[model samples]
Target: MSSGNSRGRGTGRNQGTGRKQEPQKRESILEYQKYENKMIRVKFHGGREVQGVLKGHDNLMNLVLDDTVELMRDPSDLNVITEKKRNLGLVVCRGTQIIVISPVEGMKEIPNPFQQ
Candidate 1:
């Protein structure tokens, strides 16, 4: 008799399919590419926000940032926002935790900061 359990079977979403998943469109890559090595703001779940330099990223949209600064609002006064800066130097942020990424205004661009 065949086992009824579907576990361990490679039938999950975007998995175990014979066909290769199409590569990400160039436009999407280009859009994020422009932000590389630039100072940007990242908002996350639970009202947390961070600003840092875009160091690297992956297909999963995970990010590596340098000079990270975390922002938070005062729990007693929601209207009051506080800034806590830390010299993280480098950090890898999970893609699932990211809410949005926006370019920082009035900051000079660092051309090809990733070049060795």
Candidate 2:
């Protein structure tokens, strides 16, 4: 009679090859670690821009921003731009629509408003 258990046996796939498999390189849209917990400007498709503190992100580059503000340019006059403040407190932006992510220029690090 044979035991019905198959534990601790060399019966699994890719066993005993003695060759170390190379780690798969993961694709990422941005080096989000550097931008974490910092204020960043996110430019999206259709010429929309958002400025907020980068709260969090995922491998797909989907972002969670705090104290977000939406920036738009006047269609009639390209030079005339307007900003609409959003009270979302925390906003999640889809990665696919993101065009660029950059540090906010000329601004020092901002403290999290939610913490205070």
Q: Largest TM-score belongs to which candidate?
A: 2
List pairs with backbone clashes in candidate 2: none
| Ten-residue stretch with the least lDDT total in model 1 | 79-88
For all candidates in order, the CA lDDT equals 0.77, 0.79
Model 2 per-residue lDDT tens digits across residues 23-93: 77887855788878888998888787788999888888789999988776887865445664545568999
**Candidate 1 lDDT by residue in tens digits, 11-97:** 657775677667866444436788888999888877677789999988777999999887667878764557645456678989889
User: What are the clash counts of all predictions, listed in order?
Assistant: 0, 0
Show where candidate 1 strays beyond 4 Å: 1-30, 106-116
Q: Candidate 2: minimum summed lDDT over ten consecutive residues — where?
A: 78-87
Q: After superposition, how far is residue 64 of candidate 1 from its true place, in Å?
A: 0.3
TM-score of each: 0.60, 0.62
